[model samples]
Target: MKKAGVTPHIVHVSTAYVAGARKGVVPERSLDHDARWRTELAAARAARESVEWDSRRPAVLRRLLAEARKDHGKSGPQSTSAAAEERRKEWVENQLIEYGRLRAQSVGWPDVYTFTKALGERVAEETLIGVMPLSVVRPAIVESSLKHPYPGWIDGFKMADPLILAYGRGILPEFPGLPDGALDIIPVDIVVNATLAVAAAPPPVDEPAYYHVGSGARNPLTFRGIHESVREYFTEHPMPDGGRGQIKVPEWTFPGARRVERQLRTGEKVLSVAQKLLLSAPATKRTRHWQDDLTRQQDKVDFLRKYADLYGVYTEAEVVYTDNKLLALHRSLPADRVEDHGFDAAVVDWHHYLQEVHYPAVTATMRKATVGRRTSNSALPPLKRSANGGDVVAVFDLEGTIVASNVIETYLLARLCDLPRSGWPGELADLVRKLPRYLAAERRDRGEFLRTFMRRYAGADEAGLARIVHDRLGDALLRRSHPEAIRQVRKHRAAGHRTVLITGTVDVLVQPIAGLFDEVVASRLHVRDGRYSGFLESPPLVGEARAAWLRRYAENAGALLTESYAYGDSYSDRPLLEAVGHPIAVNPDPHLYRHARSRRWPVAQWKAYTLPVGDAFLETVP
Candidate 1:
């Protein structure tokens, strides 16, 4: 800035956490002693390039392929590439978050934000401290306005707000902290006042000032104080629970961060074991129900773990910053201006600010935005005039849709039942070794999963496998299939609608069932010299490939797509289901259930053996 006639000054706003892990009265001053600014800045700048380089490695791409297949497998080749990029971005972001936090912690700071704040101060001092007047105003956990503009005004949730809401809504049953530790919360208005004062009258050019705008030293509010205030506010005003009146708030126990993390880990381990055991189970209604329950449990565990890891450090910290320069600036002001424009922490009331201002701002605003709305799981009305069956077609997904068995279970049933009891353990062990890759393939590309899984039959005669498919496997499948789903297919066939069974399952397994349908589209295994080649003849009939195939088939058959019906169960079947007029979700997994809900499509649970009258629609409300 040009400073020929006017007194020029730079009032830089920084955070009080520059004090880092130092346990003492943190005075208002520069905390830059170690030379880390250059290294941290360089590392931050080159982080993405470093991550991109690593992400391209064969192993990393293999892992990213699964995620890409999940979200973009059916989207197209372009979407698949975009998915890979999106996953790469997420990988880089996660790496940066962990790297920053660990690096900051290594140097005694709590998190990356504070460590970088200190770096900013270093840059400012090196660039302008000696050349011009500079005053750095460091605020501690700046929250809603205390008394500026309005009492309870904030743009969004700040540092402490998530924790507060979590506690109020009873999502977090325990508080992780030092019960007596001072929480250095400062109102935005006070920070603003102190910043303006420093800017209006610049500090002396010779001595650069660091003003701490916080309430930790003077009005030190402890964990107990905060808990009581929050409790009082929430006890008076509990949140709504749909039609269940009010949600109950759990009384918090002061379990330190370490113990809480341990508890969460235990829960995670237990859930993991259950999930593994259920992995090989048939996709029965009971199994899917248990899986859904475990999914919700895992989600909650993840949510709590995230909050505990991110906010745990600050909540447990006992750092207290002293606002000496800020108080001195307030003292320098005339007595008449102090009331209207003062940076006074001691005069602020903790309970009043939290209960009347901050908490109200959070609860009232949040409730107003979400109270009147809920996701409708009901399906849309049927078409007014039914089209002729000759003009319409019906499409169905094989696994987790018409049948209660996935690729793994069906293949295992055929293979294990065909082999002697003695060879069962060896076959199972080999499958266990390749389970992760197979699972990834199943989510990403059904055809890939089918091809890879069928490689186990390489040495066996094609006649024997076909025998298993036509006889024992067919009987097992009949017992395992969804009756309601089969009934729907028969209904369409009887009405003269062309029924098509499209699946990534090989032709052998679907051949016995082909008699029930007018047309059957399935994956084909390449056979060389009457031995299985463990490869596919064509691209899998899945993802966007399925949509393209369906379009071609409909055009040749003169099937009216808008008058047709389609049923699917997994996210990979989304393209097929979405191509038709009537899309139904049958025994849908988590992703498909959410998609079906968002689209308000019919969702079925096909209880396999016996589906009750009123239990047609699945309740995926977790």
Candidate 2:
């Protein structure tokens, strides 16, 4: 209104949560009554440009990526078109969320959403207060309508709605919440009515007018009460899940975040073991097909836990929203008009609303969606290599391709030596001893480093080294497989293409990942008379050498080179990638990232790392 040079009345709809990370009585007014946003806003803007902003992002992205890698087992549309779009949307949302989370952490907000909403209020107050009539209506958590166009009307799950739905379906095993804490949920119609009332009636220009359209002050609903109501309702009516009986009501747990994290990690390990065992089982021997179901349920559990972490603050808060302005406004409304506009919270029956309206509506909406659908386990098992042709194959680089870590370095430092490579005088001595060779290798070729590192394993018994790798480095190597890389590898296998692992790392080091592939191409350390030869049996299988190996293998197997796929992580793998019809740059180093962009090749960042792509890196993308 001020921008248009007119003093129009404005009703800015905001959230009562903007009161932020606090407890006790929260009045319908700004927290910073001294108006510190005038300076704080400037500081926030500057922080975005400051070095600290750039410095903090790697850690934030790492955390987000850690969570994103987990599967929530929700089955999305199987159609190719929808699947691609869904993946894109998920990626974009995750990126934006990570950016906002980092900003929130730096600026000291509970979360990005609330922090941004608070900033919006400041914008209105700083820019429009004196020039225009502004009425800020801060509504607490809004749910389906109590009474409006329809009693159970809700467009989609919002705020606490998902938890309510999950509870009804018996999926929410436990929720983190304070039993006595006020939930402060309000109906959509009441908020809308209050907003209209404020907009229509100007409450004296330039006066501080804030209305709390919430239920805590009048008809309160605690988190415990909400859960109880949902349980009771589902027990009575049950979820309309096409005859699939609802699971029992979940037990609520109020353990702290740290406890929850520990439990989740433990659960993940157990589920992972189950999944691996299921996958390893022979196709015809297993009595039941538990792989898909187990995978799906595991994903759902992870998703629920993540949601709990995101909204845990609200569930545990003890804030009571003061709605004096809202009550006074309702009283001033014409008696006849009150019936038309449902602004009263006292009339809302929580039990009836939950059972007769909310649960049914949410279930109906969910049923329309294709997500979380269970499929029959009637399909034949995965194809064996002997049953497949050699027409197509996928060549993958091991170190940065299959896993994010360099196995050679890890093996040398952690498994080979007696002294702890990561601590004390051992680390210092190793660094000092290897400093000259490392410098020499840098001045020479990339393979020089590999050769120098391999000398550390000289005269080591091959059998003893294999045992050491299995005992120490095996699990760590398997754990670092990039989700995207794994998906791509599976995609190729599903298409009946042979999978190959090619790397410069010696066979002993790459043993953990070897079984996943049909053939492994790697440098082999030569031994004579069961003693040190300290020389490669063959040239290091990297760069042009890797490409040559692929060509020779393709020719021998009669594989269609142009129909094959390859994934690599560095510029050195350019020859291997260029040799294939389909090439992907996975977790690329700086040089390869630019080259991939220039060539319009698809790029994927499977792991978070601090690789600078020049000063414009952060600016050039969201």
Best by TM-score: 1
Tens digits of per-residue lDDT for model 2 on 1-622? 5587766887787888887677689887765733355576676566545533443466654543333322111111122223344544565556556666766656546687777778788888777777767888899888888778888787778888777777766666767778888888888888889899888787656775898888888899998898788777777766654345445676676675567667777877888788656544532213133543565568567777778768887888888888887888888898889987848787788888777877777777665552444333222223234244878878998777777667344554333333332453565577678779775663344576778877766776777667656765565555656766677677677778899998878777777767778898888889877644668887687566677889999999988778787888776687778888767777665445545655656665565233332211222212
Q: Which ten residues in a row have the lowest lDDT in candidate 1?
A: 613-622
TM-score of 1: 0.70
In model 2, the clashing pairs are: 72-299, 72-300, 73-299
Estimate every model's Cα lDDT from 0 to 1. 0.77, 0.69
lDDT of 2 at 173: 70
What does the lDDT read for residue 422 in candidate 1? 79
What is the overall TM-score of model 2 with all chains considered together? 0.53
